[model samples]
Target: MDEAARRRWHQQHSGSWLQLVATLRNEGWEAQVTCEAAPVQVEGTLPSGERFYFRARHSDVSLGIGGDDPADIAEWEASESHQEASYLPAAVGEAMIRRLARRYLEER
Candidate 1:
């Protein structure tokens, strides 16, 4: 689907996105992302729950990076701790988030 379509789909399905997060953790992905735009930071977990968070400086990136592999998640290599502080929800379009979640579910 195109970007615009994806955005609409994502916005309309908030519960689906959250469901994916829980499913990920339960199915072994074990990572949940909390996106906030004010400060531009996205924090989530890895399979082992090794606190992982990254700052999104640009809209061109962050969230999902579509790939040939349905299970291909964006590679994160940063060190920040969300294990203590909390932030607002990210302003990122749900389309991206939903896209990733859909792919994960399809392959799950």
Candidate 2:
């Protein structure tokens, strides 16, 4: 992504991560924030048993949103500290979070 687009994505993704933590915490789950970089893989399983997997690098802070397993969470968290610094505006971050929250809620 271009610098501007990357910044926007970072803000949105960061916001989404924060919202996820809040939601999980409200639901009585223990959540923690991290800033490491970890191998992140997302997969979708269809009703027909078809599965799709995507591999990527993700920040630890972004991975704390949800998961039942603590080990997996910690692994993600441990990778956070190595990420590059972020310099996006707070308002942009907030807006990104709100949009992500809406999308996440709608998906549920």
Candidate 3:
């Protein structure tokens, strides 16, 4: 994507993540965010009692959120945690959040 498209993508993706965090917090769940240099980390417990950690790059804006399983959480932590790439489309980001929310809520 071009510069403008990239900026829009990042804005949408980051905004959605922020919204999700806020929603979770509003529901009385504990959420924490650490905006570091490259990979911005948002780790918290969902209302369903499952813990999740989302990691995304601020530059390229590629993001992934999944950590309910202990093994998955360990793997996520072991990974490079810094994959800079093109920003994902807003639709893609929203779809990811929807899928995660559905999975999280369904398990409750």
**What TM-score, computed on C-alpha atoms, does each candidate reach?**
0.33, 0.36, 0.43
Clashing residue pairs in candidate 1, if any?
35-90, 36-90
Model 1 clashes, total count: 2
TM-score top scorer: 3
After best superposition, candidate 1 residue 93: deviation in angstroms? 9.8
Q: Worst lDDT window (10 residues) for model 2?
A: 46-55
Question: Higher TM-score: candidate 1 or 3?
Answer: 3
Q: Where is model 3 more than 4 Å wrong at Cα?
A: 1-20, 58-95, 104-108
- Candidate 1 ranges beyond 4 A from true positions: 1-11, 36-42, 54-58, 63-108
lDDT of 1 by residue, 18-95 (tens): 655666567655454454333344345445433334444432333332233212344333122332222223333334
Q: Write the per-residue lDDT of candidate 2 for residues 1-108, one digit (tens) a residue.
A: 799997887777666656654664565444433431144333322122222222224222222223444234421222222242243233433344334334434544
Better of 2 and 3 by lDDT: 3
Candidate 3 or 1, higher lDDT: 3
lDDT of each: 0.42, 0.37, 0.50
lDDT of 3 by residue, 6-100 (tens): 78766767776577567758976667655422445556665656566655454333223345552244222322222342343334444554555
Say which prediction, candidate 1 or candidate 2, comes out ahead on lDDT: 1
Residue 78's C-alpha lDDT in candidate 2? 22
- How should the candidates be ordered by TM-score, best one leading? 3, 2, 1
Cα lDDT of model 1 overall?
Answer: 0.42
